[model samples]
Target: MKRVVFAVPGSLDTPTGGYAYDRRIMAELRQLGWDVECLDIGDGFPLPDEATRSAARSLLLEVPDGLPIVVDGLALGVLPDVAAEVASRHPLLGLVHHPLALEWGLSAERTDALHRSEQAALALVREVVVTSPTTAKLVASDYGVSADHITVARPGSDPAPRSRGSRSEVPHLLSVGTVVPRKGFDVLVAALATLAALPWQLTIAGDLTRDPNEAAKLDASISQHKLAGRVATPGAVSSERLAVLYDSADLFVLASRYEGYGMAYAEALSHGLPVIGTTAGAIPDTVPQEAGLLVAPGDVAELAEALRRVIADAELRRRLSEGALASARTLPTWQQSGAIFAAALEKLA
Candidate 1:
């Protein structure tokens, strides 16, 4: 049997898009007869302390030589020295969801350090696998990885039943993502506040623990705009509850500052929900204009205007819904994504 080790920083069951992609692809790979072992390297990655670094070093030392090992970018990008040491002994494959340097709210020095470290670490890997073509380009241009050595295995969306939409007089807007600066929940809240005159309710479902301060800021913004009754944040919901939210929502929206692939946008499309998102990162590539409206990141006026148009015009919503359903049909399945990911690793082996 072909055996490989998948190293990650935290629990495999984290509710974020990257973790979800990793779990789904790994499970699918196992079904395809590959012996995949998951190794948790502990949390606080990409900014790991000495103890965490030592733990990672020890864990890697125990892996058998010449094994094909795939490391998540979160841990791999920060461990250039470790990657260099292991390159000669193992076929190291770097799985990059996005560059760590692209993360928001970082100091210039920190960003430069991360960029340099990731560039050095990625150079030692046998190959780099990214989740989107946008990310592939970023790796090639910013990280200096050769185009020929990189592969794109985009996230796959599950087939979903068409949303029934809100049966109420007021439309329902759903946004799914962690309440972080990168996810731009603050921008979404600000834009929604401008549309208070319109008849709509907003629900943001995501992990509040990822950034407690940001969550608090979002709550303050909602209250500042006098939207306490109209806006509800139930924190992160289970898959079953998220499915219900998608099925009953009138539209899906997220003003993320950036995204590697924007899996939630794809998920919205799968449910035939019209999208309103920013043109940052891979969002424009993932959410086509026909199925959604795109605004510049942090452009509150444009976002509010787009939301108003979709909410007031029933015909527009219907047309966009059709477009979403059509677009969702073109997305790859998890099985296909797994096969592509498997092929990339196999090439290195």
Candidate 2:
């Protein structure tokens, strides 16, 4: 069995989307009888200091020479020097969900730092595996990584858990993602304000980070729109609870301005729920045309119309729900992700 080192800067215990992706990938790889070692490089935030860089180097100390390493772009992109050193010694492949420079809400200084880090990280890696073609293009164009060196591997969703007996009163409109500016929650709130008469409840499930001002803005928007009764912002829901949310919801709306990959959109589709999202980033790739409606980013009127349409037309909902579920079956499983990852490793190893 080949041994592969998977490095990232987040705890496996956290409920983050990147961590979730790593966990799934690790499990699938292990099941295939590959030896996988996980390394936490610490959170790649506010730029890593000297201590963090030392810690990263230390974490790599035990990794076997010539073994293939799968490095998270988010983590490695912040520590370009460390990445370069590690890849020089071992066969390193980058697993980029998206580039940090393209992330929303980043300041010019941080973006510059991220771009520099990313350029360095890509320099050290033999190849990169991105979650979507959109990201692959960015890697090639932005980082100057050759197209042949990048692979696009999308994710699949868990099986829909047993339905928590359907609710009859209100149609559930669910949005699952971190509550940040990138998610376009403000736009969603504005759109919801236009549809006060609809008997639908919008549930926003995500972790609220350290940004108090952003949180305050979201809170104020909810209150101002008088959507306090209609919209519920439950911070950091458990996966089991999230599964329940998916099962219970009548529709899923992801008004994200951009995404590396819309994993929640796949989850919603797997649950046989129709999705409504903007044509941003990998959303258009993840959400099948038959499963939902796609609109321009920040288009409140279009979003409102889509929401209204989903809520009022039962037949349309049923058709979309069925189509989404059917379309989801065609998505690649985690095991496939593992196989693809292993294949990438094979090229360098």
Candidate 3:
């Protein structure tokens, strides 16, 4: 039987896209008849303390030799010593949601530190799994990993009912992601504040606990713009609740400075909702121009213009929604994504 140990940091059921990808991939592997064991190595990853790092290393070392081990980049990038020590014993693979260093809003020194650490760890892995083509190219060029050594197993979208849209007089906007600087919820708020005269309501649904500072900043921005009534910032939501939010929304928006794959954007498209997002990172790759309006990342003016154009024009929204449905038909299914991941693991043995 095919067997492997999947090491991940934090809760397996975390609502973030990275965790969602891991959870789905693990499930898919089981469906494919692989003996998959999940190894939770603890959290505070990508910036874990020394104690957490040591504990993670010991947990990774516990995996039996010759059983392939796939470590999520969140933990692996910070555990260089663990990678080097176990590379020869267990066939090691890395699942990178995105390069850690490229995360927006990091100081130069922090970015440099993360880059060195991830580069060192990636060098020892047998193979790498990236979520998007843009990330694959960046990983190869920046981390010195060969293109042939990487697999791009994009997050799959389950077929969803086309959104019936808001029943309200005002257009409903939905944005989903953890409240963090990289997500640019602050930028979205800034853009929306300018268009308070427009008839629209926005709900920013994501984990507010992940980055308390950013969450606080977003709150301040909403108040500063005096848009407390038109905007909602509910924390992490249940699957059923998010589905309802998707069903009731007319437009989906996020001003993320960067995305490894933009799983939320894909989810929006799967729901047949028109998109308004930035062209940064893998967004353009995920959000086709025909289905959405793209703007420069962090540019408040451009984002505002895009938001105004989409919210104000019913014809544009309908056209983009149609395009979004067409694009949804082309995204891979979870079963297919799992097969690609399984094939990559099969190659290890």
Q: What C-alpha lDDT values do all the predictions have?
A: 0.92, 0.83, 0.93
Alpha-carbon error at 20 in model 3, in Å?
Answer: 0.4
RMSD of candidate 2 to true structure, Å: 1.9
lDDT for model 3 comes to: 0.93
lDDT of 2 by residue, 314-347 (tens): 8898888888888888888887887887677778
Clash count for candidate 2 is: 0
lDDT of 1 at 234: 96
Give TM-scores for every candidate, taking all chains together and pairing residue i with residue i.
0.98, 0.94, 0.99
Candidate 3 residue spans exceeding 4 A from truth: none
184 Cα displacement, candidate 2 (Å) = 1.4
Q: What is the C-alpha lDDT profile of model 3 across 217-259, one tens digit per residue?
A: 9999999999999999889999999999999999999999999
Badly placed stretches (over 4 Å) of model 1 are: none
Candidate 2's TM-score reads: 0.94
Kindly report which residue pairs in candidate 2 clash with one another: none
